[model samples]
Target chain A: MEFSTIIQILDSAVRLSTPLLLACLAGLYSERSGIFDIGLEGKMLAGAFAAGAMSAYAGMPVTEGGLGMTWGMAWMGVLAAVAVSIVLAMIHGFASITLRGNQLISGVAINFFAAGSTVLIGQHWFRSGGQTPPLSGAQRFGPINLPFADAVKDVPFLGPIYEGLISGHNILVYIAIATVPLTSWLLFRTRFGLRLRAVGENPGAVDTAGISVVRQRYAAVLIAGILCGLAGAYLSLGTSAAGFVKDMSAGKGFIALAALIFAKWRPRAALGACLLFGLLEAIGNRYQSIDLGAFVVPVQFMQALPYILTVVILAGFIGKAIPPAAGGEPYVKER
Target chain B: MNKGLPKWADVVLIPLLSLLLAFLVSGLVVMFIGKDPIQAVQVMVSGALGKFGIGYTLYYTTNFIFTGLAVAIAFHARMFNIGGEGQAGIGGVGVAAVLLSVAWPHWTIAIVAASLGAMAFGAAWAAIPAYLQAKRGSHIVITTIMFNWIGSALIVYLLVGPMQAPGMVPETVGFSAGAAIPTLHDIFPAFDKHAPANVSLFLALIAAFAVWVLVWKTRLGYEIRAFGHSEKAAVYAGISPLKIIMVVMLISGGLAGMMAVNTVQGEAERLILDTVQGAGFVGIAVALMGRSHPVGVVLAAFLFGILYQGGGELSFEMGIPREMIVVIQALVIMFVGSLENMVRIPVERLFVRFDKGAA
Candidate 1:
């Protein structure tokens, strides 16, 4: 492949992986704190719908049942997405924590709830066949050019790479990229991180250390909600399509979970795993099929690659993937 | 948990109360969307149970029964098999291959052969995840979910490439007329002729009974329940975890695959892209609400069947999306499966008070 072609692919990979990166980090927090979250997909879907609907409403005129605001109101959309996702995360926490119900069951229920409610309510409110109105102009997150992108464009080999691959994404993409290091620091270099990791691996020890297990778990779940909300917001507002379509998240949340497993639940590794999955997706989107000398590789196979790789990783064909010891089990304080 | 409640109440009443709670929450959702909740229920009932609609209701019920039993069997082995969607999809491929291979002399022989093909293919698809869980220590939930995506992709590849008919559509050609199963209308003569309810409904009932026999009356059934209750104790008793996991998953996968017979050979009569729809996930709700009991599965499956048929009608008449049924299904799972203690504890307390008063 030419350097320019490679750069283009990397650009697409970065764009596509933003959501996966956000959701993967979200899972990292939740899973690291001993709560197995299967509902990340559901929460992301709900957040996408909330952000899409809210942004569309904000952009429209007051006469048409909107807030009559401009680009500034897009922030409100992000806030709405976060709030809605947090509510759902709290519901999952309530079911698995307070009620001590099966975490998997709660996750399954949340997924269905989000899948159904988003469409049902969207159809009721917007009447657009379960889609938010298409967004444009300031209503969506337009790409931002880095300071020297224009100046560096004339420089041969390094110019295109810097401009095309590294710079010029919506703010959410930059936030998603920045979040990787921030998450690594929060998870490994902080006092709270120790307690969080301890709680996931050995809640009994955390309890003995005079920490409140329930509070820590709920906090982790909340952070997961916030990160997932950013992922959803990016899906709806940051993408070029710039509006919510039905099922637009389209199993990305699960892919993020797969990336989490592939990464062995580490922050930096999650970025690499997500980007690799994203690169596969970008290649699939760019080409219908690749002609090899002997056989053709179909787009369907490319689309299915991440899932296949995740299964391979999980089966220990690559490496052993072990979850936190206390993950997925509700903690009951022994009297 | 049910120390104060009678056996009958534990088996029957708690579920009913939970169902009521689910419906109540669903009603609130309907009302929140500015629809009349009572009118929604009324419409759902008439549309699902009315003469013409009952046929469709039963058709959906047939699919649910098969998938629900699949989940229930795995639940008995203490495994959560969420790949019913993929298993059923591949089962359709199996049905199509069988029905399209050659001309059959009769529908009876064809249906039997196709059913076997469906079961085999479904079991084959599930075997990897089962083996991984049993031997490699992989999480079955994650692997099965990945398998669901992979299965769908494989189906898409098949439909678009080798299986594609001469036309532009990405579907297989219709099966031979001899391969088609008898619809409910052909047998009853009074049923709706347009509806898809077919001889496979009887198969579903038979499968339910067979599952009950397999889970309760047989030695294998005892071992499964024992393993489900306590894996350590079951292993101590000489029951191998590997044997139970593999056998249970194969059976579960086979049961889920049987659903394709109803949809493929009986109704659609061809392999299409979304053959399983979301019926696989609906099975999870049914199994949870059914408490993994055969009798309870039948009842819960019927309830979901009504919701599905009625929800379709609701979308047509009231402009409510058909997804309303999915929302209700979620609520039922939440109440019956996840939040069971919320209702059970209060009910247990009430029963304890009543017992004290009697004493």
Candidate 2:
């Protein structure tokens, strides 16, 4: 491949993988904490809508509207989204943990509620059936040009890679990448991590040891909500600056679940899995752009790739990838 | 008053409570939206119940019975086979394909072939998810949801592409005249032209009875029920979960596919002619609301059928958004999710093995 084309591919890959990475990290937090949170997609969509609506209401000031939008304002919007998502995730945790309801059913219910509430609210607020007004380009995330890339433009591989792919990414892309090791550390190397893992594998053991399952799961779900919120923000503030549309998260949350399986529920492994699925999705979308006329792949088939791969990965490989022993079992404390 | 009538009262009571709660909550939402909540509800009710409303409601109920039966059958085997929607799509496709390919002159042969073809296709579709679950120990929930999306896209591609009937509006070709379900109007000279209710309703009723017998009266039923209670125990009894999973999923899928006979053969007369709609998913709510009993399911389906038919009529008469029906449906599912919590009173559990009878 030409050096420029290689650089282009790398750039596209980062952009494509951002949302998946954020979602996987979110899944890691919740599942690791002993809550089987299958409602990540709903959480992310809610966050996206919150961010989009907030931006629209604020009316992009010309100063903050440009691609050079300060890190502060973007972070503020992302933080707000996270806060909103956290509230919703808390509801999920309350239902599953506190009420001892069926986690799967509760999660599905959350998804339906999210889907309906967001659309109804958005339609009323924006006077549209779906979607918010697009953010001004100034308000949208733009590329960052690092120092020395200009000087290294003459270098063969290193120069092209630095100047082309890594330089122009939006802020969220960097955050998504950095989260992998951070999540891994949080999941495997800390006191909290041990407790979290113990709760998932053997909640009764955790409870016997005096650690509260409710507290641990609530924390885990909150972390999940934050990450999901960031993922949502990336879709609106980072990718398109377009408002949230109905069912905008699509099936990405489930794809993240698949990534967890592909990674064998390990945070670091999940990064590779997310990247792989993202690569498939990125390639599938571009297949039509670079067509082999006789070998034309239908868009429907192409779109089905991630889900199909999920099924294959879950059903074919990953032999004996067991979840936490007490994953779906609700803990009831006798007063 | 009939014997065991109090038990039946609970059945009506629970759904009615859910309905009332959904309406009240939604009414508040409508008032917030600056619409007349009372008028909106009035329009919705009259539209569903007035004049020929009963006919359409029964037609809608027919689809629900098949979908609900499909879901309940799988639940009895402890399988969460959520691919009813996908299976329905494929089944509808099979019906459409048969209608297009068949040159049969008799309507009876064509209708039977379409229905059977649909059931077979649905069974095969569900088997894929069941196989993944039994063989690989993969969770069926995620796989089945994926299959629903894939199935939907497949139908969309086929209908708008290769399966497109000539001059049809993004739909399949019209079925042969012989393939149409014999309408009540044809059987009764004085029948209403506006009402097209057919014999599919009777088929739904018979299917419910058959399902009841299958779940409660036979050795296989015992095995199925045993598996549902505890898979490990079922395995200890020498019953293979793999075999049962496959059998139950296929049976469930086949029943769900039968909805096409009601909709395609009975109403639309061709599959590609319309969208798969959400009957299959709604079936889940029906089964849950019915507490997974065949008799209860029929009643629940009819109640929902009325709301669905009436909701549309309300939209026209009272100027409420038609989507209000969807809101209500979602509420019903929500309430079903919380029903166990709502009824913490621990009434008699009928499905559990009877100690006295066993002794």
Candidate 3:
């Protein structure tokens, strides 16, 4: 492959991987804390719809339910997405913790609720055929080229890779990148992280130590919601896309969950896995029909690669994935 | 968990209360959206239970029963098989391949052959995940979900490439009329003449009976129950976990795959992508609410059938978003499946007090 061509592919990889990375990290937190969130897709969808609808509304005239397009309005959209996701997270926490509900069932319910409510409200408010109107100007996230990117375009290998592959993205991409290290430190090096890991592996032990297992698990789930909220926002608003489409989160949340397991719930590994999955997606999009000596490969096969890969990996073709020992079981206090 | 409660209360009262809670909350949601809740409920009820609506409700119920039974069987083995969607999709391909390959003179023979094809294909789709979980310890839930997406994509590719009728649309040609299953209208002249409700509804009932017998009366069922209750104890008792997992998932996948017989041969009479839709996921809720029993599965499936048809009517009549129906369904599942304890504990306490007073 040509150097510039490779750089372009990497650029798309970075852009596409942003959502997966965010969601993957989100799943990591929830799963590591012993609450598997199958509803990541739902939460992300809710976030996308909220951010997209709110920002679009904010950009419109006040008479039309908008706050007049401003940077703050977009930020408000982000905040709304996070808030909505947190509410959903709380619902999951309440059911699986306080009520001792089935975690998987609660997660599935959250997904269904989010998917349904977002479209219902979106249709009622926008009347735009199950989508939010496209945002413009300050309401949508625009790309940002690095300070000296343009000047280095004429330089050789290093310059082309840096400029083409790493220079420009919407601001959310930078935030997602920064989160990798921040999440790593928070998960592996902090007091909270130690307690959270302990809670997942042995909530009974954590309980005996006087830390509330319920609170720790809830905190982890809420943190997941925050990251997933950003993921949903970046998908509809921060990316080159300008509007929210119903069911647009597609299966990315599930794929993110797969990536989390693939990384064995490690934050740093999740980043790598997301980027690799993103690269595969970019390749699939770029080369729909590949001819190697014989008949061409079909487009659907490429599109299905990530899911197929996840299943294959989980089927133990790679390495065995071991979940937290105490995962999926409700903690009960003894009398 | 069963302390101070009768079997009937555990079976009936809890589900009823959960259902009531779901409707009340759904009503509030409708009011919040500025729609008249009473009118919405009235429209939904009339639409679902009245003349033409009853036909579609039964039609959807037929599909739900198969998938619900599929989930129920897996639940008995303590396995989470969420790939019913994918299994049914593959099963559609099986039904189509069989119907198109043969020009059976009668619908009776064709239906039987299509069912066998569906079961085989569905079981094939589920086997890999079952084996992985049984042997390699991979989580069946994640693997099955991933397979759903893969199955959909595979079907899309097949329909667009090799299976496409000479048209540009990504669907196969319709099945020959001779192979079309007889509808309810044919069997009962008094029934709605054009309702898609077919003999498959009868088959669903039969399948439920079969499941009840298998889970209750059969030795294999005893093994499955024992394994589900405690794998370590089951192993000690000579009930191999591997055997139970594989056998149960095969049965589950086959049941789920059988849904395609209704959609492919009985209704649309063609192989189309997305024929399964979200029925597979709905099966999970149905199984949960039904407490993983056949009779409960049928009852729960019928209720969802009503919700789907009625919800459709509400959206059409009141301009409520169609998505609200799904929200309502989700709420029902949440209350009945996840938050059952909220109502159960209170009910158990009440029942205990009444018993004491009577004594």
Candidate 4:
């Protein structure tokens, strides 16, 4: 492949991985806090719908049945995404934490609920076959060019790499990348983070320390909701599509969950894992099939690679991927 | 051994109450969409239970029964086999391969061979995940989910490359006429001739009864339930976790595979992409609502059948998306599976108070 081709693939990879990175961080918070969340897909879907609807409404004129606002309304869309995702997360928390129900089942229910309701409500509102109206300037997160991107573009190999790979992403992409270091700092340096990790590993110990296990878990779930909301918003707003398509998350959430496992629940590793998955996807998208002199590889195989790799990793072929000790179990006070 | 609630209440009442709650929420959603909730229910009832609709309902019920039992059997061993969709899809391939291999003289013989082929293929698909879960401690849920994606990809490859018919369509040629299972209308002339409900419905019922017998009346069943209740206790009692896991998964996968007979051989009579549809996930809701019991699974399967058939009608008549049924199914699973304690605690308290008064 040519250098520019590689750069282009990497560019798309960066764009695609932003959502995975965000959702992976979301899963990192929830799973590290001992709550196994298979519902990340559902939360992201709900968030995407909320963001898409809000942004579209914000972009339209007042006479055309819209909020008639510009630039700042996209932020409101992100907020709406977060709020809706948080509500769904609270439902999962209520079922798993308070009701002490099966975490996996709750996740499954959430997925079905989101998959069904997003389109149901979207169609009811838009009558566009479950899709929000296409967004435009000021309504979507337009790409941002870093300082000297234009000046540096004509310089050399390193210049094209810098401008093409690093600079022009929507605000959410930057936020997603920035979140990794912030997450690492919060998880490792803060007292709250210590208690949060403790609850996932050993809730009884945290409980003995007079830290409320429930409160820690709820907090973790809330953070997961916020991160997932951003990921969803990024999908509908930050991407070139600039509209919510039905089922548009398209298994990205599961891929994010897989990235979380591949990363072993670390923020830095998650970024790397998400990028790797993203590159795989970008390569698949760029070239429908790769040709070698001897034979050809099909696109389906490429599409299935991430899931296949996750299974291989899960099977302990590479290494044992152990979950947090209390993950998937409800904390019972007296049991 | 008696809990706060009576046995009958535990078996039937809780699910009924959950169903009621699910419908109540569904009604609210309908109202939110500026549609009449009562009228929607009326359309659903007539669309699912009316003479023309009942045949389709039964056909859907047949698919759900196989998938529901598949999940329920795995549930007994505390394994969540979420790959029913993949298993059933692969099972369709098996049925297609078997039915296409020979032009049998009799439908009965062909059905038997196709059923075996379907079960074998489904079990084979599930074998890897079961082994990984049993030996390496890989999470079954994650592995099975990955398998669903892998299985779909495999189907696409097969349909496009090797198994493609001599046409533009991404499907196999129709199965031999003898291999085709007779629809319900063939035996009962009163039913709609085009409806897909077929003899596979009987097979599903038989499978359900067999599952009940295997789970409750057999030593293997005892070991599975014992393992599910407490893995350490079962291990101490000499029950092999590996054996229970593998056997239970094989049975589950085989049962899931049987759904192909209804959809592939009986209805479509050709191998097509997405043959299983979302019936596999519906199995999860059914198994949960049924409390992982065979009888309950059948009843829950019928309820989902109504939702599916009715939802299809709602899409045509009421402009409600077919996905509305999925929403209702999700709510039912939420209430019955995850939020049981929400109802159980209050009911238990009431029952305890009543017992105290009687004493």
Candidate 5:
């Protein structure tokens, strides 16, 4: 393939990788703090719907210098999306923590509710079974063309690699990249990070050290909700910002969860894992455009790739990766 | 907190509260759409219980009972089995393979072969996760979930490949008359007009009783419950976790497979793309709402069946979306989390009172 083509592919990869990265990081926080969060998909769906509705109403472009009003509405949408997703997360926490219920069941319920409610509400508002109205460019994520990268656009392979491949994606892609080192620092190099890790690995030990296990897990899971919200917004606003489609999250949230587990809950490793899966997704998308006759891989098979990989990895093909000791155990205050 | 109600009051209270809470949430959604909430609820009730509705609802409820009991059996063994959907799907394939491959003179023989095929396939399907958990110490929750996706892919593959019946739209060939469940016409003349409520309900009820007996009256059941109660203590007491895990998963997968047979042989008579639907995941809610008991799952499944049957009717009549039933079902599971509390508080109180009275 030509350098430009490769660059284009890489650019698409980065764009595709962001939502998964954000959601994976979000899950990293929650699962690392001993909270199982299968509801990341639900939270992301809620955020995507919220962001789409907000962008639709906010980007009306009134002639009376309405920048303030527009920005305010957009911010309100973001806040609302985050707030709703967090409340759902707290419900999950309350069930698992307060009621000592099964974590997986609670997460499944959250996901089921989110999927159904978001679609039902979206259809009601948008008058479409699945999709929302397309946002204007002003209402959407715009790309940034870096000065240095632009200057070197004509420099053969290097130009394509640095400028065309990685330079011009939307703001959210950059945020996803920034999250990696930031999450790493938060998980490994900070006090709160230590406690979070402690809670996952051994909540009783953390509780004995005077930290509240339930509180820490709640914080971790809420962080997961916020990040998943960003992921959802990116789907409807940045990556595929065309509209809010029912079930449009399309197992991506589950894929993100898989990436987190495959990475063994480390942020940087999660990025690498997500990119690998993203490559598979990108390949599948590309393959659909090709006419390969009967030899063509089915879309359903391609969709199942990440999940198949997850099982293979979980089945000990990978080296012994372990979860925190208290990953699914509810912390009960027994004093 | 104790206001001196009967010891069993809390057990009954949680489901009642959840029903009330779910209605409130659903009521807001109804009002949001400018519909009459009370009228909508009334329609739901009548649609589920009306003469035209009860038979179909009961038919669907049989599958729910099988799947719910499938899930509950595993829950008793402390294994989180989420592969019911996939297992059921695979089991449908097994039924198709059996029915299409044979020419049977006796209905009983065909049904028995189909059931055996389904049980074998389902057990083997679940064995993957069980093997992973047993050999590699992998978590069953994570592996079983991945297996669901694998199972889905496998079904899709079969539908498009060897199992695909020629000249049909994404569906397998219909089973032979012998392979199909016999209608209850001769046995119950009064129920001759009932559409699809066939002999499968008897099978389902028998399965439920079998589950109850195996879980409560057997030594193996005692071991399974013991392991669920405390893995460390069970292991210390010489129970093999690996053996129990495999056994539990096999039984769970087999039950799910039987549920598929009921759907394909008793209802559809062919495997379609929408086969099994989300009944497996719904089974988790049923198991939870039923508190992992056979009788509880029966009641819970019936409730779900009513909701599904009513929601289907409401969607056709009032133009209200059938997806609303999903919202209600999810809320039920979310609230069902408090079942442990509902169970614990009353049991503890009863025991304390009994001790005090003796003293």
Candidate 6:
């Protein structure tokens, strides 16, 4: 394979990995706080719709019959998406925390509710066939040309790769990358992280410390909401795809869950898993059929690879995946 | 916060209140969307229960009953089997293979053979996740979900590549007439003349009863409940977790597999793409609403059957998005299954007060 082709693939992989990375990390926080979030997909879908609708309503070109807000105001869309996601996170927290509900059932209900409500609201508000209007200019994220990108262009090997693959992603991609370490530190080195992990592992210990398990879990869920909200914003505003399509998240959210498990719920490991899945996706996108002269691997196989890998990983082909001890169980103070 | 409730209130009153709350919120959402909530309900009732609509409703109800029973059986063992969608898809392949393999002399033999094949295929498919959960400690929920996607991809590959009809169409060839189950219209001429509701409905009812008996009356059922309630105690009592998980999944998968019969043999008479159409997921809601009981599953299935048929009509006639029904169903599941304690707590308190007064 040529270097440029590899660069292109890596570049797309970075782009595609952003949403999955963000969503996976979001799940890590929620699950580590003892709330098994099977509704990441639902939350991401809700985020995507909120971002697209808000951006379109605010910053689609007035020439194209938009709401006439400036490009800078388009970021209000991200804010709106975050708000919507937080509300969902609160509902999840309420159902699973305050009520001590079945977390999986709550998650499943959220998925259904999110999928239905978003489409219904989208059609009701926009009337654009369950899609937001086209976004333009600053409403959509454009590539950020890093300082010295041109200066590094002439350097050998690493130069072209850096310029082509690393230096030119929307800001959200950068945020997603930076999040891995931040999440790692927060999960490992911070006081809140210590309490969070303790709560997930043994909430009784945390509760005895006078820290409310419900409050800690709620905080973790809210963090998840913020990260997932950013993911949704990136999907609509960061990528070249500037509009929300109905059910556009497809299975990405579920794939994120797979990544969370594949990474064994570690933030650093999650980064690798997300990027690996992203690379596989990128390969499928580019190479409909990979040819090595003698034989070709079918696109169907390529498309199915991630799910297959998820199954194999979850089946302990590699290692035992131990979830946080108290995951999916609503923490009961007395019990 | 009270834990105890009268048995009658535990089963009936909680679900009723939850259903009422779900509908109340759904009504608010409908009104918010500029549609009259009352009119929407009226339309839904008329569309789902009208003679013409009842047939379609029952057809959908038949599908849910199989899948709901599938879920309920797994629930009995505390195994969350979320892969009913994929199992049903695989079951469709089994049904198609059997239907295509022979020119049977009679529908009776053909239907029985197909039913057996579907159960086997679904059970086999489910066994993968079950094995992982039992032997590897992999969470059943995540593994089953992955399998759902894999199953869909496999079906797409087969339908597009190998199983495609000789012509350009993307489905398998139609089943032989001998393999086709008789529609309700054929069995009961006195009933609606063109109902797609079929004999599979009867089979679904029988399967529900079978599951109930298996769960409540049999020694196996006792072991399953014991294991689900306390694996440590059950183990001490000599019950094998592996055996229970594997057996429960197989039975659940078999019941889920039976869902394909309604669509493949009873209605479409071919293994078409998306034949299951999220009924597998809907089964989760149905089983929850039914409280994982056979009698409750039947009633819950009928309720969802009505929503589905009526939702379609609602979207068509009143311009209300059919997806609204999904919100309602999810709300019902949330309130009834997850937040059952919300109602149960208050009801228990009330019952305790009544008991104290009587004393």
lDDT tens per residue, model 5, A1-335? 76666666667777787888988999899999988888888888888888777777676556633333444454455665677788888888877776777788788888888887887777677667746667756567777887799789888778768788778887778888898999999989999999999999988888889989888888898898888878888888786556577777776777788788789888889999888878767766665534478676666777677777777767767677788888888887776
Off by over 4 Å in 3: none
Off by over 4 Å in 2: A1-3, A60-80, A148-154, A289-295, B1-23, B167-169, B183-197, B313-323, B342-359
Q: Kindly report which residue pairs in candidate 4 clash with one another.
A: none
lDDT of 3 by residue, A1-335 (tens): 88778888889999989999999988888888988788898899999999998888788887766676556667877887898888888888888888888888888888899889988888888898778988777777788899889999888888887788888788899999899899889988999999999989999989999999999999999999998899999877886668789888888998888888888888888888889889988998889878876788898988888888877767666687788888888889877
Best by DockQ: 4
Candidate 6 deviant stretches above 4 angstroms: A60-66, A291-296
Model 5 TM-score is 0.91
By summed lDDT, which 10 consecutive residues of candidate 3 chain B come out lowest? B187-196
- lDDT for each residue of candidate 1 in B141-212, tens digit (9 for 90 to 100): 888888999999999999999999998899999998899899999999888889899999999999999999
Candidates in order, TM-scores: namely 0.97, 0.89, 0.98, 0.98, 0.91, 0.97
**In DockQ, how does model 6 score against the reference complex?**
0.73
TM-score of 1: 0.97
Docking verdict class for candidate 2? acceptable
Candidate 4, residues A197-247: lDDT per residue as tens digits?
A: 999999999998888999999999999999999999999989987889999
Candidate 1 chain B, poorest ten consecutive residues by summed lDDT:
B1-10
Residue-by-residue lDDT tens digits, candidate 2, A207-275? 888889999988888888899999988877787536677778888888888888778788778888888
Error of 4 at B87 (Å): 0.8
Candidate 6 differs from the real structure by a C-alpha RMSD in angstroms, to one decimal, of 1.8
Judged by DockQ relative to the true structure, which candidate is superior, 1 or 4? 4
Q: Specify the CAPRI tier of model 5.
A: medium
Worst 10 residues of 1 chain A by lDDT: A68-77
What lDDT does model 6 reach?
A: 0.87
Worst 10 residues of 6 chain A by lDDT: A65-74
Q: Write the per-residue lDDT of candidate 2 for residues B162-185, one digit (tens) a residue.
A: 887777467877888878777666
Candidate 4's displacement at residue A160, Å, is 1.6
